[model samples]
Target: MSEEGSSYDWAHKAFLQAFLSKSVMTVDEIKPILAAVMSARDPNRPTLEGDVTAPLISSTIQAINERLTSVDYEIRSTKDQTNKHTVYALVNTTSDSLTQLATTFTPDAIAYIKRVLDCMFETNNTRNREVMAVTSIQASQLAKAPTRSRQSQVGGDEDSSIQAEAAVKSLTIAESEKVLADLFDQDFIYKSRANYYSLAPRALMELRTYLKETYNEPAGDDEDEPAIVRIRDCDICREIVTVGVRCSNRECNVRFHDSCATQYFRSQRGNQRTCPKCKGEWLGDLFVGERAANKGQRRTTGGRSSNVRSEEEEEEDEDE
Candidate 1:
């Protein structure tokens, strides 16, 4: 297990023991109880055993039962029956639940984690250029549209010419401009600005073929490279990082290919840093689910009377 996880495990055990000990439980009292329990036990030990250790175990367990009994009437009534029982009896946690929690974060937590990642990835430059290329294409569409319009006006019956021009302008073929443009237009593309895009969640994934073709790196293996590798797909383009690189954020262990990282970071400038998966703050924790949901609920409820009136009219029209 990770060192931090180990510490939390020790802390959690101590907390349970201390929390159960007191005649009267108060918020301020928890820390000291925790401190006492931790002081008595070896922090590194996964399991505590032996006859010599029995008294400490019993004391801690009794304290927990007492505290739980005070809080729950069911426990209070069953308290006598569990007097000499093992400490594990009072702690009701499933191994599966604990395992799942350690491996996976809740949706809200994932968002929070992503926010921090977004900030770190936004620091790259090359990736930024790619993003700008796509945005420029979109914004310039009106200007480009006029050219098509002019051509159509001059040659109304020449559908083949129009198709050729469209094929040329679209990034589908081989030109860098159209290729970049189409890549940015994908829903998986999250653009921070004119020159930035990211391969975020709810978007397409980077293909192996594209990576091999665009980046000089080979498609299969990198035997010469160090065992420790940092690679990330572009959050906007769904392009795999061909360049060797790692996420610069010390706190975050994410890695990305140089090109992919650059695009992700550049797209993040003057924008929010968020993980595409969890949307969590890379540096801190912030829960926005409740607020967002509440706002949505308010919007849904606000125009209800008008919506009802429209629905009634539609039904009446059908009847007529």
Candidate 2:
């Protein structure tokens, strides 16, 4: 069959349309959509044949991606940083003028989003502190338009400063709150129980390239030297690890998702789990993101309270 003929069928087209509506869905969530589409296509089909299995959904997505390649769009899958569930996101492979125009957000809204991303990934994310998240209060504080400094106005063209200030649209606090709520609804960002805002799985998958290019910097003079990356990848699965276990050695940059760390350590020969890069012992309790703060609180409290657990309990929790 020709590329055109084989690439997409009625089912594929329907699935594409359904996926575009949300741009993000988990494996479990996707199963129902697949079933609904398939059943709608042929209501009289046998129940067994109509069944939406994992393999069927995978093959359907594969076909859709093959067609989407021409337009630089793809359905990419990744594990959720917090829950470890599989998630699929329809992402634009290329970031171009056309892609920018296609976004639902206005130019001003996009700029505000960029600032939020900067706060989460650059300002809060550092070698010493890699929180990679912002509180709701902090996000709301960014609603105001950035002001131009008097020195910049005097040193450079005064018109340029005026133009720059005019370019940014100042959103009210209520408007900022609405924008954040919309972002959550669209699955671009997620709020934790602690009310901290972090990039959702869809955002991670969609903006992986952008994040790396913007935040990562070369650590050494040599071209081959690994860059000091703000967004680190899992040592096991190689996916971005925003919320995960970090190597006990502070100098070591090795990180893994909670599940990935558990699975990797399970395969180790000795009882003593060690970091693959650093020779130091792997401390499972050392975590990234907001979990790290909670861990610190537990330590500061200094007792076998309900919040604190033994090493054995930690291992059991990992297994669960």
Candidate 2 clash figure, as a count: 0
lDDT value for model 2:
0.75
lDDT of 2 at 123: 68
Candidate No. with top TM-score: 2
For model 2, give the RMSD to the true fold. 7.3
Quote the lDDT for 135 in model 1.
30
Write one digit per residue (lDDT tens) for candidate 2, span 53-104: 6677777888889988998899999988778788888888875322352366
Query: Per-residue lDDT for 54-117 in model 1, tens only?
Result: 3433444454455455443111111111121111222212322212222433332322222322
Instruction: List per-prediction Cα lDDT, in the order shown.
Output: 0.33, 0.75
